[model samples]
Target: MFFKRGMLVTQAILLNMVQLLTVLLLAPLVKGWINRSNALFQSRRGPSVWQPYYDIFKLLRKDSVIPEQASWIFTFAPYIYFTVPLVVALLIPVLTTFPLFMAFMGDMLGGGFILSLGGFFLVLAALDTGSAFCGLGSSRARFVSFMAEPVLMLVFFTVSLVAQSTIPYIVNQAFAGPALILAPSHILVVLAFFLVVLAEIGRIPVDNPATHQEPSMIDEGRTMEHSGRHLGLLRWGADMKLFVLLTIWLNVLVTPWGLVGSAAPLAVALAITALLGKMAVAAFLIAFIEGCFAKLRLLRIAEYLGAAFVISLLAVITYTMGI
Candidate 1:
């Protein structure tokens, strides 16, 4: 019996490792797909879909140049930025619904906090460089985060009301139920969360991922001083963050089908395929929206986020009304 238990533990550990690697490796492909889709909408051919991988590889092979005045925080921040999302990925139900290693660490609320912690570190790192661009970017990033975080929390709380717990897997399982999907409250929550994802990933009307123009940049400004491996890590981390957020939006809140409820191999394989298909659909939709909308001015972002908050609040109110 002890040997059998050990074998089960080993299998779980292997599965967890595979899931982590999958998230890390697949992140860039999602970004690439989004970029490619946007290019197609513009009637122009873009860079290869595998361009991100090659870019990272080139960056890794080069040496990073640091400013003379930069502190240790500036140097170490990229690794921290990269690691936090990887940790969150483990906690979320990316590949399988079954609880894996580190499953007990926390639930959906805890996952949000972990993500916030990483964002905080990123802000500090941006400040550590003392560059005017980084400072401006950091300030704007914080402003958006300050307004968006509460709405995000509210969305989570609204969803939790239905699941009766904050655990992501349980919430996903709850969302998979036919009754919850059709609930007016749940539908509102999903819409609100979709808006949040746009802001969180620095998408259109919030921030542009492809621009270096100072007037319209938030995330890019923060990384202006980083080069070589540091830049590689930062870019890679950004991609992973996007992938993780989309996975949560796709598998947890939006389309919660085909997620493995058991440890069966075939079920897990099918779940992964379904997850990719959903991601592709999501990527195309997001790219189309991005191509259609212009980036909102910094002050206007407040109103955008305000609308999200109001929508999330309506979700809670709707739930209370039991409609």
Candidate 2:
């Protein structure tokens, strides 16, 4: 009984901190893992697993060069670019309801909507750099955000409609009650959530995180100007973002069981396993996607994200009708 109480909200806070560090720290490892995976798929010898860490460290130690046209905003932009995602992602629940700012969510729908503010600022900062590439990429990023964000909100709305509230914790509870996974509504929500994962991660068919090709290169284009420690942080932040994004995606299913009561230990272990398992599958799926497809025309971006929006709408409808 004493042990149980010890693991209350306080533990949640501690655990949240740990989880955040895991995201921040393990991001490079995750990137390396993806690269390793991609190489194997292509039958190449591949880079070392620790290569990303080496690159980040080397970058951090290098001197930065500023462009003549660049304002202080150009230098300042990287910090903002890196920090906002960290803050927004820090707001997400992980391992359980344990987060430094779990309260920020207020509820799932509200949190989902609020997180976009960070994306908005990052894109704006990209444009502030004033480089031709930065301008083009930032404009593209904003357009992509515009196209993808509605679908994201609509997908979250699916959960809200089902639980009759948008609180992720509450939604988890509602689904935990009975006849959980068997619920078709949950399946639809998961499918919708998967698309949000693709959109937010800028994965295949949405945006390629790997390439910096002409015309189609969006995020990388804006980021081209960032170098030295600034670039290091941005790359690290992107890796951390994948972790955070994966956590949110996993929460859609794992939270349903809640994280206390007789099932606490099992729930915790299983949730971790589920997260790792999901991330494993997610990594492969993303690679498969990237490997299978070529880049699309810049103008066609809207149609791709629009399809996701339509699916999210379907998810919302599925929840509302409770089919």
Candidate 3:
């Protein structure tokens, strides 16, 4: 019996490792797809979908140029940023429905706190540089976070109300049924969460990732001083952050049907394929939205996230009312 238990533990560990690698590797590809799709919408030929991979490898080969006045936080933030998504990956149901090793270590709320901790480090590092733009970006980011936190709290509260738990795996399972999938509360929460994702990831209508105009840089500004491997790590970490957030959006809140039930090789392969398809569809939708909408003025961002918070609040109310 002990030997059998050891084998099970080994299998879980292997599956967890596979899931972590999947997030780290495939993240850039998803970002590339979004960029390519966005370019196609604008009638311009964009960089290849493999461009992010090339960029990361090239940056990794170079040397990082750190600011002289910068403290240890400047050099430390990148590692934390890069590792945050991987930590969250182990907590979420990525390719499989079955919980892998460390799967129960933390739930969605814990994952959110971990993500926030990484962002906090980056913000501190940005402030530490003493650059005006970095300071501006850090302040703006903090303001956005200030507004986003309430919506996120509401989102979690509503999900917990529906699922009776904050655990992502359990939440996914709860939403898999047809009734919950079609519930009004679920729809509202999804919309709210998507808005929060857009704002958090520095996407269109919040801040433009492609723009380096300085005045309008929220996310980019925080990392502008980073070079070489440090920049590569931050860039890769951003992609992984996007990937993991989308996975939660897709697998937990949107379409929870494609997750594999076991660790079988074929099952994992099929699950990955299904994930790619979902991500492609998501990329196209995001591109279309970005094309249709202009970036909101910084002042208007509060209202933008405020709407999300309100929607999530209404969701909670409706759920309690059995709607």
Candidate 4:
């Protein structure tokens, strides 16, 4: 029995490692695909889909520039931001429907808190430099976060009400049922969650990633003071955060159809293929939105998120009332 338990632990560890590497390696590719798709929608030839990988390699080979007045927080925030998503990757159902070794360490709420911890430090770092642009961007970012958090909580409430658990793997299993997947409350929650994702990831209708203008900058402005390897880490971390959120949205909140069910090598390979295919479809939809929609005026941002909150709240009400 002891030997059997040891082997189980070993297998879980190996699976966890696979999850980590998958997040790290594929994140850039996902970002690149989004950019390329957005460009295609505009009838322009964009950079190759592998461009993000090249950019990261170039940034790592350069040196980071430190602001004269910066403190330890500035140096520390990048590392924290870079590491939080990796921790989240372990907590979520990334590659499998079964919980891995570290999965029990944190449920969905705990993982959300960990992701917020990274953002909190990043806000501090933005303020640390005392740059007008960084401060502007950070304030806007915080305002957006302020608006989005309630929707996120409502989404969690709705999911917990439906699945009766905050654990991601269990949530996925619960969602695998057709009855639950097609429920009115589930559809409402998915719509709400997708809106929150765009706000969180600094995508269109919230912020324009393609625009670096200081006055209009939201997400990019917070990291303006960073350069070289530090910037690389921040950028890569953002990409990984996007990948992680989308993975959760697809594998847990949307459907767990493509996830590997057991520890078989062939199953894992097919699961990876299906996962990438799903990601590509998601990327195209995001690109379509970004291509067609303009960023909202800063003052109008709250209204946008408020819609998400209302949708999420309705999801909870509907679920509880058996609608």
- Per-candidate TM equals 0.97, 0.84, 0.98, 0.98
CA RMSD per model (angstroms): 1.1, 3.6, 0.8, 1.0
Error of 3 at 231 (Å): 0.3
| Local lDDT at 166 for model 1 | 77
Question: In candidate 3, what are the lDDT values of residues 136-176, reduced to their tens digit?
Answer: 99999999988998898889989999999989999999999
Poorest stretch of ten by lDDT in candidate 1? 260-269
Order the candidates by TM-score, highest first. 3, 4, 1, 2
Higher-ranked by lDDT: 1 or 2: 1
10 residues in a row with least lDDT, candidate 3: 95-104
> lDDT values of the candidates?
0.87, 0.67, 0.92, 0.92
Candidate scoring better on lDDT of 2 and 3 = 3
For model 4, how does the per-residue alpha-carbon lDDT over 1-323 read when each residue is reduced to its tens digit? 99999988888888888889989999999999999999999999999999999999999899999999999999999999999999999999888988887888998888888987888899999999999999999999999998888888889988999999989999999999887999999999999999999999999999999998899999999999999999999999999999998998999988678888788878887887888888899999999999889999998989999999999999988988988
List where candidate 4 sits over 4 angstroms from the true fold: none
In model 2, how large is the Cα lDDT of residue 77?
Answer: 61
Residue 189 accuracy (lDDT) in model 2 = 64
Give the better candidate number (1 or 4) by lDDT.
4
Instruction: Rate residue 287 of model 3 by lDDT.
Output: 87
